[model samples]
Target: MSSISSRDRRHLTNGVKEHLRELSVQLALLNHRVSAGAGLKQVDLDCLDLITRHGPIGPSALARRAGLHPATMTGILDRLQKGGWIVRERDPEAADRRAVTLRAVKERMGEIYRLFGGMNAAMDELCEEYTPEELEVIAGFLRRTTDAGQEVTADLV
Candidate 1:
């Protein structure tokens, strides 16, 4: 929107697009490695990640987030529960007390952490190159990209 040349803007946009694709592929590879390490399918691993991020939520809410059928969520939950990666709990004192919520098992998180710790450590090292002001700009860029992705997904739904 500034007075930047159109060719320069196009080059910058293409760079961002390629970086996003590379990030997606890297994440998929990481997912595969971690899931296999934990004896889980990739989708189940992704479902567990969603629960870790958005829990403690109900199964229906989880399915909605994962774009899966309610029945499909049940099986995924069952597997995770059997593996002791998550639990379904209910609050007795709350209204609608019979409703269940999903949460990750804290103890089992070590496996996930171990699988991801190397990448996280590398990212931490990379952050050291940037000043706080630079980081703020980087964070804003990441947040905008995430918001843009969510907006697109919402539009499709």
Candidate 2:
């Protein structure tokens, strides 16, 4: 049998890297299609969580809360607006022009939640095998990953 050189090994490794990169992109696109069909993209879900926690907020504030750049937030808002999952209204308290605020279209929220077959129900299914403490630990790890570069890595596709 012939032996392989170091260069050959490097080419093999590069091939694996390229394969994995393509797989990751395909999976990400599949996830987006699934989530959007379910009435939410990942960003839309994040924005909903922010609105649920903070009540009404401006797009700039939502950008900060979502840990996304303003341009990224604009795209998310566009999808959300198209879905009727969110809306923008002028802030009554602000006399100036730049006071428009973003908020959940509350009436559509329940339908959105229902479209996902009730998020809690789905999460419960996923967590069923884990103890509460174990689930908490997993959640903590996921949060940390997200707080770092996981969010950006996810959007790379």
Candidate 3:
């Protein structure tokens, strides 16, 4: 095995742990604000995101995409439907069958998107302190981390 000093390993490992913890705290706060009183949780948001991006899909597919179990996705659809945030329509190709799809009620969701957009803008401004090359390096690192996570999780199935 290649040898690395304990100090060097600790430096790399501690930075990764610190970054993960900070990301978790930040995401929790963001979710709290976006999901407040919506009778929805983070999984619900993930379902919505999948539907929004991919258009109408069967509950099974939606569940798979959102990393949810099939039965739980059914419950999520019911809640979203009851809230009028999503609608289920008969699948044109399949008579007497419907697909669960989601669309944002623009009036209700626009404000949230705007708030999110504002936060992004602020973050971008903060990032301006770094040169474009520095930001590129950071982005590359993040992308590699994300790709690795996806690969490892995909292998578990």
Candidate 4:
């Protein structure tokens, strides 16, 4: 195999950074459109997604994960509850009666899923072009990128 020169490596690194930045912006725009179509704010929709993926989760924990203030999370949760998108349940097993967990209204998730169906399908089609090893590498890269983003966000927050 031919070794990459330092200059070529730097070029490839810059290209990857640019593409990742573009991908982030495009994803945000897509989420904004999907949120609009679903009649929900983008942040609210994002919180709902978090709830769906990590349900039986406490409000405080969810707030941390979403990088939202507790007050902001309260409003979002209220709206979601009012819209029938989520349910807040008191932890019966806990000593504190006020400890509440958030859960997504699974039946009401169809609309959100339908909104994202096109993008999901496209992603699946794209994945079809890659072999298992290539897919694994892609997945690993994405995972590391996400972790890095979260780390930076945590520092800022």
Candidate lDDT values, in order: 0.92, 0.76, 0.74, 0.94
Which stretches in model 3 have alpha-carbon errors above 4 Å?
1-6, 37-39, 91-100, 114-118, 155-157
- Candidate 4's residue-wise lDDT over 30-127, tens digit each? 99999999899989999999999989789999999898899999999999999999998989987998899999998999999999999999999999
Clashing pairs in 3: none
Q: Could you give the candidate ranking by lDDT, starting with the highest?
A: 4, 1, 2, 3
As a TM-score, model 2 comes out at 0.54
Per-residue lDDT of model 1, residues 60-147, tens digit only? 8999989899999989999999999999999565589778999999899888989989999999999999999999999999999988
Return whichever of 1 and 4 wins on TM-score: 4
| Clash count, one per candidate | 0, 0, 0, 0
The TM-scores, one per candidate, come to 0.91, 0.54, 0.73, 0.96
How many Å off is the CA of 44 in candidate 2?
Answer: 6.3
> Judged by TM-score relative to the true structure, which candidate is superior, 1 or 2?
1
TM for candidate 3 is 0.73
Q: Which candidate gets the maximum TM-score versus the true structure? A: 4
Please list the residue runs of candidate 4 whose C-alpha ends up more than 4 Å from where it truly belongs after superposition. Answer: none
Output the lDDT of residue 86, model 2. Answer: 76
Model 2, range 50-129, lDDT digits (tens) per residue? Answer: 87678688888988766699999889888888888777788989888768887888887765566555545867898998
Query: Candidate 2: where is the Cα deviation over 4 Å?
Result: 1-31, 34-55, 64-83, 93-97, 118-120, 150-157
Residue 58 CA displacement from its true place in model 1, Å: 1.2
Top candidate, metric lDDT = 4
